[model samples]
Target: MSETISPAQFHRAPGVTDWRVTGTGPQAVFAARSLGEASGLVAPVVAAAERFGVRPDVDVRPEAVVVRVPPGPDGIPAAATDFAAAVSQAAHELGMTPDPSRVQSVGLYVAQHSAADARPFFVAALGYEELGDTDAVDPLRCGPQLAFNPITGDVPSRGRTHLDVFVPADQAPARVEAALAAGGRLVDDSYAPAWWSLASPENHGVDIASWTDTTD
Candidate 1:
């Protein structure tokens, strides 16, 4: 395995213009004409992974092909940059447009301040494994990763669990605008470009977050 690198470093590498650093790691989206066109990318993606000895997650949609390269325990490995570039090249060869706007990570956060231990219950119920100190992840990659945050139990208004949308810095504002127009109200934008906590019409909590300073 190559040395681990920061998100900014990976983003600045050549041929990664179509990629973004999500909550997990480097990911890219390519617009396709149809599912058939999207499916064509899988073979090339797998070949790239095999060449680099790293496994990448590929999701084919009717209009897009999303690829996520899982990071190492510490951070993204330098090898991922080359792998990402290969994927981007393959996408262009197929006449697909690189669309970084659609790349984002949707994670769940469970704020527990009660006395009883809830991690065990969640582990068994959700079939998750411990991911660092305050997070649980599905080994099968079936669902979004869940984070356990420390918060005051007295604040019922803050809610226990919330959806976190980790998107590219360049696309954060647009995403927030679309959500607000969808009937959700902004709870807090003090963190602007970093994150925005919003609430649905029913008061369900959701946050749009970004880590990169800019998309450059």
Candidate 2:
């Protein structure tokens, strides 16, 4: 297996300014003017991955082409930086620029005393694969990862399950503000730029986490 790299190292890699180390892996979004143009990027991205012998998940939309380096046990492979850089360079050749504002990912979290005990149920119910011992991931990777968060004493008032929204660091504050303006209340900001937990008007739980992909 190739060596694994830390998020910090990935961020510092050359030609990867367009990429971000998200909760799951290194990802980037290149903005395109049309669906045809976006689709044009798919082959080049796949070619880069083939050249590097790495797998990348690419999503083409009308306005953007997103490429994500699939992560391994420890983290993403060191070669992921090369893949990301190659993809970025190819997008640049097409007159596409990376859009940090559009780069984000989401995950589901379950608060419980025993993460292991609850793992099986979610795995069976959602048809997800076990990620290590206490987490589960969607096999198709189309859904958010579900992680079990341990709690000791009291159950959170918001509920047992919550959503963790991972956005670019620069876009985090505005995301929190918009949630609050839309009837959500700030439950906690003790973590500041790391994360801010909020409760919807109906008492659902969500955490805005922004610690990923930053240099601080």
Candidate 3:
């Protein structure tokens, strides 16, 4: 064969913050270095989360920051009317527009409380199967996966999780409203008619949405 050379792969800095844009797709993956950095990107995602009734969690690591876009039927569409608003807010907060070229795969996680009897309820109610358990680590689900762990006191300020709930989308709105009727208050009202978050009876919060795109 004739001598040929392939393009070299460029290795980016570990945890480099980036905004993922691919082929007019609906998902928007954001990467960053700190909570402060991710704040710039939070507004649009938060608004979308509220409209779609999903929660977008801020995946914070010492090395990098990640904002995983929630999926739809219940997920906010990549082209949401409020999308730009959210992004602009983040831009103001970050002091720069996030680099779109450095995007990476999204990360997902879940939490419960150490004191709560959540395992049985998760398995039976949410259809989450057990994966494994450790003394320190919470029980994990390998299929229809569930990441059950002790609540770390409180959710991060201006942050939430893109959780998967085993409920119908049409039913989500009513369920959420009922929770409110039962005295549950909204975490934020920025996004509506799409996703609305509410604190649960146990004070553990859940994002009620229409779809289940979790890695179960």
Candidate 4:
């Protein structure tokens, strides 16, 4: 399992609902009815973040804008909360819904006989920068984080890698059902609420998970 960041470390302000903290920092996704709305959000959101002195990674999708606020020097948690608040207010004023529940982060897991030997190839191929020894992350924060897992024995016939999708706790059940409807087979669900491991029609593994304990 990857290292888990405690929920207490991700402080949320009063008006900022649905923002989540991951390995990256506090992240929120606002839903736009169309591409036009998504585009329209850029200027105001950027302006708001700048006003708060926070550098945010803003990804404009066809129907959403994914915002990731990086931890700051003074206090990462507080900074993240402030940044989220500003962005949330901007989004709400623009008729956008703070559907952070729909926000998801994916990480690519590559199982290798020797992680060191395999790491360089992926980093160079994807033009991804290294995040410590075992992971490579996209500098622009648009792509998924790549994690190298070392396997002891013979590699599996299916593949050496899989995808892990992290969603908000409340959305996991619906996500799992949708995956099943799409012909995905449940591999394991004993870890319920933490993660649900499933295999695609092609037998590729995809684990839908919640990074924080959201039972509360």
Question: lDDT tens string, model 2, 62-123?
Answer: 98988898789877799998898889888999999899888889999888764235778888
The digit string of per-residue lDDT tens for model 1 on 12-92 reads: 889999999988788899999999999999999999999987778888999999899887787887889899999999999
Alpha-carbon lDDT of model 3: 0.42
Q: Model 3, 1-216: lDDT tens per residue?
A: 222111010012122223232111122334456666655455655765676444454544433444543333222343332343454345546655443333322212355444554556556765554445611112331233445556567543323334433333234567678778897878864554445666765675655543331111
lDDT of each: 0.86, 0.86, 0.42, 0.74
Give the per-residue lDDT of model 4 (tens digit) for 99-135. 8666777889888774235778888999999877688
lDDT at residue 79 of model 3 (Cα atoms): 36
TM-score winner, 1 or 4: 1
Model 3 stretches astray by more than 4 angstroms: 1-48, 51-54, 62-64, 73-81, 106-216
TM-score of 1: 0.90
> Worst ten-residue run, lDDT, model 3?
4-13
lDDT of 3 at 161: 37
Worst 10 residues of 2 by lDDT: 150-159
